[model samples]
Target: MIIGTAGHIDHGKTALVGALTGVDTDRLKEEKARGITIDLGFAYLPTPAGTLGFIDVPGHERLVHTMLAGASGIDFALLVVAADDGVMPQTREHFALLDLLGIRQGLVVLTKADLADEGRRAEVEGQIEALLAGTALEGAAVVPVSVVTGEGIEDLRSRLIAAAQGFSARASEGGFRLAVDRSFTLSGAGTVVTGTVLSGRVRVGDTLKVSPSGLSARVRSIHAQNRKAEEARAGDRCALNLAGEGVTHDAITRGDMVLDPALHAPSERIDASLRVLPGEPKPLGAWFPVRLHHASVEVGARLVPLAGDGVAPGGEGPVQLVLERPIAAASGDRYVIRDTSSQRTVGGGRFLDLRAPARKRRTPERLAQLDALMETDPAASVARLLAIDPWHVDLSAFARDHALGEGAAGRLAAELGLVTFSTPGARIGLSPARWELIRAAILAELTRFHDANPDLPGMGAERLRLALAPRLARPVFTEAVKRLAGEGRLALEGAWVRLAGHEVRLTRQDELLWEMIEPRLGGVERFRPPRVRDLAGLTGVAEPEIRRLMKLLGRMGRVDEVAQDHFFRRATVAQMVAMVRQLAEAAPDRQFAAARFRDRIEQDDHSVGRKVAIQILEFFDRHGVTLRRGDLRRINPHRLDLFGAIGEDAVNSGARSSQAETVSPDEGASRQVL
Candidate 1:
């Protein structure tokens, strides 16, 4: 736990820390020489409860930013007011800062009691009580002590110990992040950086990324509170020896983060809910420029109000910070915004969207999205986001936006019964309720398709995906389909997807026509079949009805029409593919002339001749089943995957060959097999 000291200069903050812990926090020679604390310093006190870290902040008004930087990670406030001077301007400002930082636990330290008489001290005490009234520190103990006299020091120590006992353990979620304030090169160690671990843990040999810059490094060693430690967790002040590519003291600096790479990607815009300090001169307007200090970094930002004309003093509203520079941040991070000209803290905010888009930020829909982010309940937030999308949402993005760890996200998702879909590059999710709606939509749509085209097979995968969620990305929809098929709610047959028990059955008239037409197309003369007009005349069916039935058969993958009207059984097409592959393999050059191919087909049916063979070859070319080089054609080699291997029965009988492999319903839908 870190306790940050805040007050006016010359309040004996450094002396008080030294008296309590026996360590001088003023390490800078310049500070000692100038008789003032100009930078942040550190000290520690050990008690039975635990080790308590002390951050001695510079109390001068000019160094309030320095105090803010140190205050970002502190657990409690140590407001020191000099008894001789009572509550001064810097003391009040420092108290305001601690309050703005959302620090709710701390006691008032009234030092230099040796210089004040009882009546004077009582007057100062009165002033201190009035100042702290209605604040988080209201009714907190006010201890008066003098470094020289050492009076009340032990009592103050006991108060600290009591506070530490009640301080809840810090949670180490969302992985490790240390806000760096000091970086330097050690004698033997290449480079060393120090900061308080705000969350997560770090260990030797762990990979860490420097944020806002994204430089990666490895931890060589670690020390907590000036002693060697194998690992450091949240609430511990740690220093790390880092060694990695292009990493050194020169490359390191303050305001950067030593962070877990998995949880971070620095960005400039931050959507947030903010409250303007009650005493601010005016409302925080849209496009107002301010210095935003979050963690250890400060950058110029334009505050764009999302919900109102302006946020009045003590008013709360949604806003987006358009930062001039990126900072390592996540949802729920606290920040203070200082007025541009005066550089005084005007308001504070918590990060809601670390990667907010500049567009549509003012829309009600977008505002509702930001509102969902404001919820403290993880399960509610996850469900809300998933409901906004009908298809699938990126799981990692959702978790990160919610400031939840992978484990937490999983727990929440499980609580809400979300179906997860994973790919090599993304983890996608669908709310169980929403997924039920999509499943029903798919069944309804496919049922309609089957009703309209009862003689045809199921719809193509791409077309079905569009029918389900046209706006959804391909990978997301693909994962959703995979999940659905795994659940036995759908079937992905060849290249089409259909409801669990969907099927196509032909009418009695179609069956009789097919029975008459099937034989003529499968006979030895199959490769060069008669035209549809001749078949209609021979079958005694009208030409129009025969044409429509033949089309239905083609859509069912039962027939291959190579020319305008010439049709062949799909089994005959498979046989032709196997024969071509055999001939190509037998040829010395591994290729066969189109003329030779046509001649071979003609050998089976003299009616086929050259034109039919050319049409088949063109069909193969359009489907990527063959490579054409001038007069010769080379088999695609993977053609068997498209049309399965031919059987001996096909080569031996009038009805030989394996049932034709269902061509992918999408591969050449626009092309007529030829």
Candidate 2:
């Protein structure tokens, strides 16, 4: 268990740690000369229960950021107050910081007891009690100790041992993360970093990433709990020797996290629940500048109140933190905010959303989302979020932001019995009931569409998706449509989605009009069908009516608009592919010029024009049915059935002729000319 010391400067915090462990925690030369703790120091004591790690923090007001870094991952707190000074200014500030950090298990120590009489000791103890009133450490034991006299030191050690044994270990099931507090190069080791493991475990040879910098490194060795070990888990203070490219002692510093690479995303905007300290002179303004501290890192940030013009002193509300630079942070991580000048702590809170939007932030929907994210249990937060209007959630992003282990989201989804829709980029989850509602809504929309436009094949996929309520992401909606099609509940053809039984049938009068138009686009002239205007003139039908029917036919897959104002019969397009295959086989190297194709059409007794032949080749190129290089074109065998299946007899005949020609000794001479 890790225990951090908190008190005012020169309050004997470092001396108490030394007397208990028999090791001085103030290792810095400046701290020793000044007789004050200037930076964070560490000491460890072994007991029957386990090793108790002590993080002795600086008590000076200016170094509160350093103190917070040490206190972030501690299992217990040790509040020290000098009997002579009683509860001083730094003592109150540190106590408030501990309370804001939610450190509940701790005991207050009244030092300098040898100098203070009984009355002075009692008075200081009363001051300490008043400071703890209504806080997390209220009712905590208070011990008076003098390192010089060796009084109450043994009693403090016994109480610490009991607390260590009673302390519960943090769960190591999440992804591994350690906020690096110290990094430097050792004599023999390349680079060494030390910190308390925040979650999961790490072993020798494990590859870990330094987040925000995106540098990866391999762990060469580990010293867990101040002793050499093969592995270190959550709640253990460990030092790691890391080796990799660009991984120097300077590159990875305090505030940078060594974590699993999967959790490498960094964000600059964060939405959180913040509480303004009651001691503040006035209300927190709508836009307040502060220094934000999380884990071991500090950065500048602007706090924007989400609900109102400002938050009153001692009031709590939702707010957004717009950072000056990005930081690697996760949801549920605690953070403290101090004024930009670092003179006083302003407020502190836990992050709710890391990827908060910059616009419409105060909307009711967004506020509701922030409320749901406040749930401590990850699964409970997800459940509440899924219950919102969209009725679906991005499971992958949620897992990443929460630093969940691999496949943890999938397991949680299974536990919730949610219907999951997976795309290449993301996985979306919604309740099974919600899934059924979407399916029913899709079916109802298709039914209404078929009734209104009986001649159309179906609704466009995008249009259908837009028509549904509780709009879903495009990829997720596409996946849902695919699943419905797989279950035979709907028919998905190319870009259209429809009911399984829906079929387009032209009306009797339309059928009569199509009969008059079909003859002109078929037979010898099929290679070059007339335009809508010419067809309208020949059939004596209005141009608009003919154009509308042609468009409807395009949707029904009966005709393709080979080019602007030029529609070709689907069957004719298939036959044209067969003709192109035969010509390609006859031509040298299986590549024929457009002039040759037009000549072949003329041979079939159709006066096909040069412009029509070029349009047909361009359409084939667009659809992957033909490949063009310069003036020559070759058939793409894989796309032969792009329009519809080519006749087997025509393909076989072309294949036999090509085989005979290849076997001929004069084949090379014949291939020289087209």
Candidate 3:
């Protein structure tokens, strides 16, 4: 079991722990020399209560942040109130924090009882009882113990064992997360990292990563509760000897943590339950500097009280603490808050959500909703998360918000049927009713796009991407689209897309324009279409109309754009391919140059000479119809016969085509053309 101690400085917190465990928790030289705990210390106590791992924190008012870092993971707390100066300033603050942290199982150890009069001790006990009233410790045992006299030490041990026996063993079978509380260098050893196992289990030789930095480390050795152990489980205080380049004592300071590679990430804002010290003068407001401690973190924060104008001193409220740096903390992690300037212990609380957005306070009701979450039940908390405006969330984001481990949030979502996990493994909001609404909206959008642009088969993927971009935003949105497509709700036709059954149509103008352009393609043997200006001029249609109509035809795949300025009737290109192949085989003497073939077939119809020769030759060449002779026309006989086919097929076949389709093909007829 994990045990933590809370109290004012010099109240025998360290001494009381030493008397109970026989280990001096004060490891610092200054603390020993000055007789005050200056930093966090650790000790272990093995009792019939099983082995209890003790985190001895500095009781100095300035170190309350350090104290908070150690508060949350324990099963119970040892509130060491001093009989000599019962209920000091830090004592009250500590008590308030305990209440806020929800640490219900604890015993009030009124230490230094020997230093107070019997009547004074009774009076302090009464004060302690009143202070703990209505807290988690309201009905807990308040055992008065004097470390010097060993008074109530045995009784305290028995009570601790009994309290611990009530706790079940932690489930160590999950993703691991360990918050580094101490880092030091041992002689002959490189770097030693120590912290309680917050979750999962780590064994010697296992590879681990220092989260936040994602630095890798080899677990050189593992020590559980200060004894060499093969494996360390959740709740075991462990020290790991590490080997890695990026990890160092300075880099792996308190608040930095180790987690399963998959479970590590940084969070910017944290939603938590916050309480102000009852003795404080005012409420905590937006961007107020406060020391925040959670998951071995001792850092200054900019407190942003949520759902309320601000929290009154001694009042409970909801707030978001914006850290100066990102931290590896999650929901349900208890934390302590204090006024750093005054070195005063203020109050502590538990995180309700990590990664709460930073929003300005505009509506009082909105802010109050956040405040109510702090006091809400589990189902209400889940409902609140679901009710967040713009309710879509990444699975990882949801996990961090609830402080649930890997897959835990997913399981919860499934259990509640508040969301659905798509086949692509993305979470999408989909309670049965919610799913129907979203589906209808999606289908309606597709229907509208199809109705508006019937000439095109569907919306372009880019257009769809843009439409969903705002709602999904980066990473998650991309995932959502893929999931939608995978589910067969949409069909992607090239760069264009549409809902599964959307069909293309043509307007009256488009139909007329297509009819005019259809004849310009000549016959099936002539695949090329006229240029945009040529077609528009010939058809008596405007260029803009032709361009828009062309886009529609192209989308339907009925027309093929063979060149940037050239549109081809698909059937015409197919016929040209057949004719070119037939002519190439039939003319053994003449090279099947476009100009030569044009001359032989119908030379006066510059249309045939112009169209078939040039267009078919280019189309054939594009479709792999060219010969490998150094010059193609020189090897043809039939083309040479047109000029002067005086030799055999081999020799005459080398002659160049005479009816080429250049601006002036006749001028170069006598010369060779390849």
Candidate 4:
């Protein structure tokens, strides 16, 4: 077990720790000279509970960030509140940090009882109670001790032992990660990195990477409580002698993590809860400079509470901090947000969201959600987190938000059933209850489109994307559509999408309109047909509805679109194809003029000339029946044989026409000066 001490400066935190461990914690030369600890000092206690490692952090105002980094991996905190001073600024801040870190079991040490009179001690006790009233320390035992005179020192030792024994064992069976807080080179050894092992186990020969820098190192040796061990497990304070190409004291800095390669990714974005320092200009909502500390890296940030207008100083608000630089910290990682200007410690909290999109300002509803998660259940919080976006979530992003270790995130994902993994890195979507609601919304819109325009193909994929959830853009939307299609509720056609079994059905009036417009082109040889809009104007049908009916006919292959707004009934085009093929076979050498072709077909109907011309040209083009050279449509024997004589028919028809003599579809003809 690893135990750490926390409280205000001069609260006897180091003294009380010394009494329990028999090792002085003032390790720095500057600290011993100045009568204050400027850095962390380590000690080992041989207790019946286990070989407990102790981390004594400097409790001074200026070193609180250092205090946080030292305290992150501890199993329980020994929170020392002086009997004379009661609750100081650092005392409350440290309490907030520990609680934010999710440290559940700890003992409160009310030290220096020898200096304080009975009344003073009693008053201090009451104040400490008030300070810790709603925090995790409310019901914890407050042990009174005098480290100076050794009075109650034995009692403090026993209390620490009890706390250690009662603490839960760290999980040791997953991927390994160790946060390096100190790196140095021993005379004989090349380099050493020390931190409490947070999860899994690290053996002497294991290969690991130092994060943020991504330096690879091979473990040369392992030390637990100053004795060599074959392997180190979770909750052990370990010293790893790392040797290899990238191992260097300067390369591995404090606050840098050493972790498994496959599990976590390094990120610069953070979502967190921030409490304002009383000394700041505004509580929150107003931008205040922050000395943000996490994973042993201290960075400058702008903290603004996103959940509410302002968090009164010493009050927490659901906030998103814009980091000046990236740090390697996962969701659920506890952090300290202090005022950089004053150097006075502000309150700290656990990270509620890590991959939050940028926010211009705060909102009350969002804040309430964060508050509920911070004070409530983590599992339920994750479920709510999945709802923040409309698209399939990044699983790695979710893992970082919850500060889950190793396979812990996979376990949580399996429990929620929001998605499934096809391979190690690939994610496939599923219809969780929440996603089901989104799918239903999309399907409803599709039904509306199909109902209104029965003749047109149901809403195509491009239009459907525009109507999808605003957050589901491009790639994410693509995946959502595919997933919904896989579920069998939505049908996917070439470019068209619809509900299964949605058929294009036309009304009787539209069908009668089509019949009236169908047979107008019997005799003429050229191919200009009436525009659908003009035809609809004559039939007294709405133009758009008529166009929809035409498009439906086109989809079913019952009509052909000759131009933008023109259609030819299938019967006209098919008959024109047969007539052209027969003429090409009958007159292989003849050239025909387009005007003469009109006279040959010679029906009295004035519309026949233009309509048959439209049909003849469309049929030739569709079957590769004609070749145009200069302004003339030529009939070639090769095209006649390949595409079946449509060009020959145009040449034969053009032979008798009075205007420019264009070849019939069946006859091979070239323009000749006449």
Candidate 5:
């Protein structure tokens, strides 16, 4: 367990730590010259319980930022106050900052007891009690000690061990995210970084991502408390030697974190639940700049209150933090917000969302979601998440990014009966109520599509997805489709999806037109067929409607579209394929003349013209019917079976061909055949 020091500057905080552990914390040259703690120092004390690490923090008013970095990862605190001086300016500020940070364990130590009289020590004790009355340290033990006299030194040690008894190591199950407090190069070690392991575990030879810079490196070695270690778990102060192809010491810095690569999105706006300190002089207005500190990093940010126009002192509400620069943070990170001038701490918050919308952020729907977020339970979170997002949420990211454990998330999902759609590495979930709504919406859209264009096979998949939920992720949509198809509720075509049991059925006028158009494709005009414009003119139907019906027919395999504006019945294309193969030998490089085959088909079918003959030759070219070589076409021996076999006796010639004619229904020619 790591115990941090907090107090005013030169208040014997370093001297008190030295008395207990016999280690000089003030090691820096400037710190010794000034006779003050300029930066954070470390000391380790061994007890039967374990080796307790002490983080002696600087207490100067100007070095509060440095103090915060040390205070972020401590299990308990040692708040020092000189007996003669009582509570000073920085003593109050450091206490407030620790209270804002939610440090629940600590003992108030009144140092310099040898210098102060008994009455002075008693007076200082009263001041400490009043200062901690309502904070996390309320009713905390206060012990007076003198480093010069060694008075109460053993008693302080006993209190520390007692506090250590209650300290439990942080769980080592989440992603390993360590905020780097120091980054430097060693003689042989390429780059080394040291910080307390906030969560998860790290070991030698582990690959970690440094963010929000997006550089990755392999852990060459690890050290815990100056001792070489193969692995270090959460709550252990660690130092890592990193090496990789492009990793350099310059790429890393204090406040940057090395974390699991999965969590790397840098955020500039955060939606958080904030509580303003009650001691503020006035209410905090919206868009007020505050010094944001979390995980050893500090930034300038403007708070836009979402609950009201402004937040009264001591009032807790949801707010949006628009940061001046991006920070790699996630939901549930605890942070302290100090005033921009660094006079004092203003408030502290728990992040609810890393990516918050900049507009309409105070809507009732959004506020309700924040309420659910403050609950800090998985089931409530899932329900609110499903309610707000039309598409499902990526539950893995939802839980991890929200600081919810994977096991708890799984239990809540099972309890809530969430419908899950999954692909490799991702599982997206929706509430049962939301999923039913989605199913209803999809079926309704498909019904509308079938009603409007009954002649079409089905709606395209991409179109159906966009119509249902335009913002839905592609993987989630694909999983939903597969789920529906597996349940036999939907059928998937090549590129179209439709309700099961859906079949193409044309309108009455379309049926009459089909009769007029079908005969044209079956006889001498089979190779050329009839164009859509001619069919519309022949039947007096609109050209657009005719084209729709023709496409519908093509989908149903009633017509083979042979080149542009060319159509043939399935049987006609089949017959022509046979004649071509019959004219060529079964050799691999067999060639046939396009003109000769065109003449033979024209003679056999009694058809005429370039449109019909050329289209037929081109039709054979496509479908591997034959490979075109200028005037000649070669038979693809592999596809000879597609030609089918025909008896020579059945290949009879037609005397006259059908005429391509057009008529108007108003002219009493509704039944005109082309």
Candidate 6:
């Protein structure tokens, strides 16, 4: 167990540690000369339970930031109070910081008991009791000891060992994260960094990334609890010997973190639950500036209250933190906020969401989301978030933000029985009930659309996506549609989505008109079909009626609109594709010129116009059936069946017309022309 010392300057915190472990934590020259702790110091003690690590922090008011760095990951606190100086300002401040950090397992030590009588000791005890009245350390034992006389020293040691025995080991289930506090070069060891392991485990030869900077390093060795070991886990004071490119003493500093690469995402905005200290002189303003410290990293931030204009003194509420620069953090991490002047502690809180948005932050919906994120349990938070309006969560991002190890998210998803859809970039999870609701909504929308527009084949995918409620991402929506089609519930034809049983049919009046137009466009001269004006004049139908019926036929996969006004039978288009394929095969380089294609079509019908042949090749180019470069064109082998099944019999006898009706005009056209 790691124990951190907290009290005012000259409160004998260091002296008590030295008495307990026989090591002087005041190693700095200035500290030795002045007889006071200046910076952080370290010592270790071994008992029957295990090793007890001591972090002796400076108690001067100006060095609270340094104190905070040392106290960030301690498993216990040792509150020191000099009997001669009852209670001081730094004592209360340090005590408040300990409470804010959620360090509950500790006892109070009243040093210099020999300097005062029993009445004086009793008065100091009263002050200590008042301080601990409503805090986590409220009924903790207060032991009075004199380091000079060594009175009650052994009793204090016994209590510390008992506390260590009762301490619960932190679970090592997350990714490894070590907040680097000290980095220096050792003679035999190239570079060594010492800090507390926040979570997970790190073994020798394991590669870790220095977060925010993204520098990679490999661990050469480990020293846990001041003893050489092959590996170190969470809740241990560890020293790592690292060696890699750019892994130098000066490259890494006190605030940086060496952690798993998956936890390298840094963010500048954070949403959190904040509380203003009751001792503050005034209420916290809506836009307050403070120095935010978390896990040894300190950065300037702007505090914006989410719900109101300001948070009154001692009031607790949700707030957003906008940092001056990005920092690597995880959910449920506790943080302390000091005033901009760095004099007094304003408040502290726990981080909820790291990727907070700058806009719409005060909206009720966003506030509700923040409330759900305040849950300490990650699974509970995910469930609450999924229960909200969107009813879907990005499980991959959630796992990354929480620093969960591999397969953690998959296990949680299975435990929750979420209906999941995966894309290349994200895995989205939705409740099974919500998935059924979405499926029903999609089918209902399709049925309503079919009732409204029976002539059209189906709705475009993008249009249907926009028309749906609780809009999903494009990749996720595409995956859902593909899943539905795979289950035989929906039909995904080209870019259109429709019910499996939905089919477009022509009306009686339109069927009669199409009968006349089809014969005109599909006879001996099908390659050079008549335009809408010519077809209208021949069949005595209005030009607009001919155009409308032709468009409907195009949707039904009966014809292809080769040009603005020209239309041809789907079988004729398929035969033209076959002719192009044959011409390309006959060429030396598998490429044919437009003039050659025109000549080839003219061989079929002597009256096929040059303009009509050029138009057909351009249409093929637009539909990815042919790749054009300047004057040469080549048949796209992959798109051979874009129009229909291609064969000599089908081309010569026009036998694929009925089969071609299943291929939509917009199908298989995603590739660009070469």
TM-score of 4: 0.66
Model 3 misplacement above 4 A: 169-174, 359-384, 400-403, 417-426, 448-453, 460-490, 505-529, 533-674
Kindly report which residue stretches of model 5 are placed more than 4 angstroms away from their true locations once superposed.
387-391, 403-417, 423-426, 448-456, 459-478, 493-496, 507-530, 533-548, 551-674
Between prediction 2 and prediction 5, the one with superior lDDT is 2
Residue-wise C-alpha lDDT for candidate 4, range 1-674, written one tens digit per residue = 77888899988887777787788889878878988888988999887887889999888877777888888888888889998888988897777778766677787888988988989988888887887777667878877888778888888778778877788887686567788889998999989999888777888888887876777888899997657999998788889999989688988989788876554566665557765555555565546667887756778887765655667876766777778876666666677777776366666777766655676334554554555456344456666656554434454445444445454444445555554322234433333665566567778878888888676655766688788655454554544555555555565543456776687665787668777766542335234556777777777777887788777787744666766777766555555545554444555444344543454344433545655664556456565655544433444444443222233333223222312211231332121211
In model 6, which regions exceed 4 Å deviation? 473-476, 507-546, 556-563, 566-674
lDDT for residue 195 in candidate 2, whole number 0-100: 92
Give lDDT tens digits, candidate 3, residues 437-471.
55455556778888887656677544565564234
lDDT of 5 at 477: 67
After TM-score superposition, the amount by which residue 252's alpha carbon in candidate 4 deviates from its true location, in angstroms, is 1.4
User: Worst lDDT window (10 residues) for model 5?
Assistant: 651-660
Backbone clash pairs for candidate 6 read none
For model 5, residues 230-331, the per-residue Cα lDDT tens digits are: 998788888899998777778888889887777777888999988888888887778988999998889999999998788889998899999998887768
Number of backbone clashes in candidate 5 = 0
Which digits, one per residue and each the tens of the lDDT, describe model 1 over residues 544-649? 8888888887777677677777777777877888778887898999999988888788788788777778998887787667899999889876444344344222
Residue-pair clashes per prediction, in order, are 2, 0, 19, 44, 0, 0
On TM-score, the stronger of 1 and 3 is 1
TM-score pick, better of 2 and 3: 2
lDDT of all predictions: 0.79, 0.85, 0.67, 0.67, 0.77, 0.85
**How far is 114's C-alpha from truth in model 6 (Å)?**
2.1
Q: Estimate each model's TM-score.
A: 0.76, 0.84, 0.73, 0.66, 0.76, 0.82
Better of 1 and 5 by lDDT: 1
